[model samples]
Target: MALDKSIGVGMIFIASFVFLYYSIWVFILPFINESSFIQQFFLPRDYAIKLPLLLLLLSGLFVGIFVGKVLIKNQQKQKSKKKSQ
Candidate 1:
């Protein structure tokens, strides 16, 4: 259905954005010199990396499952139409 496709697309978009943001926060931030914002946010660097990583993984999984469902539904619809004709 169109709605499924839209939901899938939206989930994928959000997942991608989160993944990119997480990547930047985890990998890129380490190299940047500590600044006011950086110090305030990543102060206890011990667990700061974990939160973004967790979010990235969860969103990635949701995207995969959602897109897979859309694909399967589309396939089923096509098969039914062929059978009906």
Candidate 2:
């Protein structure tokens, strides 16, 4: 196979989970973890910013990898089709 099926699926799955986690931790939880009213209302805080950014980056990487694998598979398919023709 031009792309490893299990790896491609796994990468996408992992990326999706990372994206979910980032959304919850970075975007959602700060409102809930209110130290004070002002902190909650005005301060847009990225709690654990670096780690989430890293996770976001990793998620992007895995997505890109999955897309590249798909493209490789499509290209191989076209090549096989041309040879058969």
Candidate 3:
């Protein structure tokens, strides 16, 4: 599917949430007491680090798509104006 501003923003929004969740789980939670209720949600040892990086990738993808759309739009506008001349 073509990437538009609206869709790109939505993806970034979701990625933000995932990144936040990952941050709280990875950084803050480690300092908390082991017996704390939040420990119950601790991710598996293998996948814990991977999930946050994956979300980071998603956010980057959204930003790239947004930039790509703007660049394409500007190029097309320039081409159209040249054609009209």
Among the numbered candidates, top lDDT falls to 3
Instruction: Tell me each candidate's TM-score.
Output: 0.49, 0.47, 0.53
lDDT (tens digit, per residue) of candidate 3 on 1-85 = 5679889999999999988987887778878888888878767555786876897999999999999999999999999999999
Best by the TM-score measure = 3
Cα misplacement distance, residue 72 of candidate 2 (Å): 0.4
lDDT of 2: 0.75
Candidate 2, pairs of clashing residues:
none
Q: Give, for candidate 1, the lowest lDDT window spanning 10 residues.
A: 36-45
What would the per-residue lDDT of candidate 2 be over residues 1-85, giving only the tens digit for each residue? Answer: 4479988998999999977765765667666747655444333454466666887999999999999999999999999999999
lDDT of 3 at 56: 97
lDDT per residue (tens digit) for residues 26-68 in model 1? 7888888786476555445666657768979999999999999
Candidate 3 accuracy as lDDT: 0.85
Q: What lDDT, from 0 to 1, does candidate 1 have?
A: 0.81
